[model samples]
Target: MDCLFEILCWNVRGLNDPAKRDAVRVFVASLRVSIICLQETRLNVIDDFLVMQCLGPSFDGYVYLPAIETRGGILLAWNKSLVNIERVSFDSHTVTGEVVPRDNNRWWLTTVYGPQTHEEKIDFLWELAERRSLCPGLWCLLGDFNMILYAEEKNNDRLDRFIMSRFRQFVLEHEVKDLYLQGRRFTWSNEREVPTLSRIDRAMVSVDWDLMHPDAILQALSSSVSDHAPIHHSLSAAFRPKRRFKFESFWLNLEGFDEALREAWVCDPGIVDPFRRLDALFRNAAEYFQAWGERKLGNIKLKIAMANTLILRFDVAQESRRLSQAEAWLRKVLKLVVLGLASLQRTIAR
Candidate 1:
């Protein structure tokens, strides 16, 4: 049996606006949030502790912990109902604590919004990973990751890949699983013409933690007041199987390309001889179709069989021309072989 749980994380940008702060109060009051984290407070004279105290009556005995704020500020406001609020990293920043009495407690919640500079950011990620390692089970890490996993993750012309590489390596070394790249698109938006968006804010956990709370999910909420959207999620005592993202369809949707590929295929030169060339073509096409079926519809073997049936039974050329699922079709082929397949289709070369 799995136990259901709920959690929230956000980079409020700054804890300034009275309405925004009040909204925070209402949001906290509304839910049974086990863990709550915030970043970029942008505080001047107000103390971090006092700001945390603002969640006073709603949290019912909570604690305010600060992280090494670069310019603005970072805070971790936890619910007493959620866990035994104990301040771990306080005096500077990077504050974390243990959630109490384990019936099936998978991870200890730790929130951080690291610095922008490479050196400072690296230090923050390394330290956070180190702290997680100490626990050695399930550790839920949240706040502005300040980094992205893929090229699609960022919207800027300038993405520091070198620094991002280090950050990604740290994630791999730490064995943390990113939750944002699952189904959602962009989490934070610069709100431009195309809207420069990136998943700077995210949540992640260990494999063991995934095993405990299977239903854990994260989504960026609308940032009506702040620049960055608020991230909301819930967890449960269920084990969700690792679902691969449908990244193929993204590649297949190209302009005036499928017809060219088919022409190229017919012109792809049937590997010598007469019957052998046809056999090879059908076999290759069958395999590609099968692989595509497996990815989109599960059952690789069955999918392959179906592809074989389609190629062997149906009018392959006509079907291929009318392939509304061109992306899915090419993806399966691309997955199987890498030779001369680049002409299949692509996403405008990044």
Candidate 2:
């Protein structure tokens, strides 16, 4: 049951607007992300409808901490088919849960949204240490920490050595490895004339957790509608079983398919017995149709991979700078293209 395990973490700022919610849905749908962690949702109440609006229909399991007034909310959602989570708990700034991925291994996932002020931030750090004590075994602590571990992480004059030391001490105590963002420097921006950027958002995993997903990749994606870029963490690729060939109904609907099939069926294997001759003819037709379909339809799986690669290129570009109108349009179009390709792939597999 080894399946794809990918998580998307973002400080979406807010999802009150329908557009932002729709944008989230598009991202989830396009990327086929299994787990989602959203910070600063700024929504006082969250329902199934809102979850569907933001994460799409596939993400059926969720837990959320409502905001105080119009600030500081967290939402964690996962696809039920891929992962089963239990022992869920939440406070003002964190959501902790025991996740069982399709591989049937158990691990803790703590999604954090650290405090802004100095005094409250200390308390938040202590709470995180406490959370670690409660969550044993392989653990993944991730999301917006709201604090930088190093001076280079932020492009600003403000540097809090005390807070940085405390965060580092916590990581050292737990022995969690920071799966630092690759290819991009910052995960958040103030979006000003002289923009303020920081790498406060990240994923940290215990040694055991890292062993479980040795090939995991972490990267910051372009933020289209938020101040924070979405960070993607993907485990090893999904295990795909060998595909069994099946006749496609759509093949019969093609223009010259009938003629091709007739030509294929007309081929004789030169057998004497009637039953054996019929069997040979059927096998010949199946082989010919399989080759013909390959030539005419092309490979849906390859197209899906190419589309995903193009989208990732756009996402990485968006992380550093805003994409052009044409590029944005193309990215959006590629999302739909991937979705259709995935559907066709599923149909062929069936």
Candidate 3:
């Protein structure tokens, strides 16, 4: 189990409007957010009243980098009771800090608003990579990155290979991974006559951070007020009961499963009232199945990730030239593998 806390990140576009600020306050309260990161606030300065109106009464402390005229700004706020934050560094594009939670566990968090232009975007990536070297422990970078990881993340436009490559390189260099997202696939929209959607807003965490908060999830909420949707990061509560035993579909494909089940079912001692005996037998079988599932399906996530990577590679290759016969067949096989794994996961959930 993990200690549950929710962090909400949004571009917000601007918070100067009273209605927009009220909407933000209502939204954050509704979500029960403990921490908030707002970008592109478009405010030259933040006062106590503005903070109170935007973040509400729950948040006790906040830090802001004021916007340069009307262009860029970043603000980070956290619940004083839940998180004790110490500012680490700040600039127009990012604010880095050390966050100590109520449990006394600490991590480094960087909230960013990447530059819009091509040259500036490249500089921002390099700056981020440099900053990553400062603190190596559980780290998370979250906010509007202003770029997408893959072509599929954008719709109604051709992918920008150069920008995508730079973003990919930054991830690889930093050894950070995108947390699996829930709800909407795209987090930002162009708000045009024909709207263009892209998942530019996201949360990326180090491998160490994932290990620390294994059950954390990122959700893309509806873009009700701003062009960019707010992203919520939720960590599970620390106290959780032992998981109930559930059958795994993949176990049926493994050898000796039936034999194992039979052995558990029949190896009952003589304390038998018929109903109690049956109950004991099933309990034993469930224990055996649980152990078996752990051994066999433990690496399923990694396997699925590998399959997705291969599929992505094939799709990218297909854009420029035809795939070879072997490549085409492998792509089909990988897709099936991914689908099968997903189906097995759904079965396990039931």
Residue-level lDDT tens digits of model 2 in 1-350:
23567889999989999998898888778796888999999999999999989888898999999999998999999999889889999866999999988778889999999999999889998898888888889999899999988899998878899999998998899899998688899988889999999999999999999888877889889887888898888886545576666788989787899799778885454677898888888878888888899998788888889999999999999999999999999999999999998887787668
The sequence of per-residue lDDT tens digits that candidate 3 reaches over residues 29-132 is 78877789999999989877889999887788898988999988998988888787885688558999998888877899999998888998889988888788
Which is superior by TM-score, 2 or 3? Answer: 2
- lDDT, candidate 2, equals 0.88
Clashes of 2: 0
Clashes of each: 8, 0, 2
Q: Pick the candidate with the highest TM-score.
A: 2
Stretches off by above 4 angstroms in model 1 are 1-4, 44-56, 65-70, 90-93, 101-106, 181-183, 192-194, 237-350
lDDT of 1 at 138: 59
TM-score of 2: 0.69
Worst 10 residues of 1 by lDDT: 339-348
Worst ten in a row by lDDT for model 2: 236-245
Name every residue pair that clashes in candidate 1.
2-237, 3-237, 67-93, 67-94, 68-93, 107-138, 214-238, 252-327
Candidate order by decreasing TM-score: 2, 3, 1
**Residue 345 CA error for candidate 3 (Å)?**
26
Q: CA shift at 271, candidate 2, in angstroms? A: 13
Off by over 4 Å in 2: 237-350
- lDDT per residue as tens, model 1, 1-350: 22445666777766666767777776666666656677776654445455554454544444444333436466665555545554355423355666662353434777776677778776776687667666666577777777777787876757878777887887788887888544557778776777888878788887787776666667666675666777777776246676543334542454534653463245247367878877776656555544553444354345555555554433465566654477557655644533222322233133
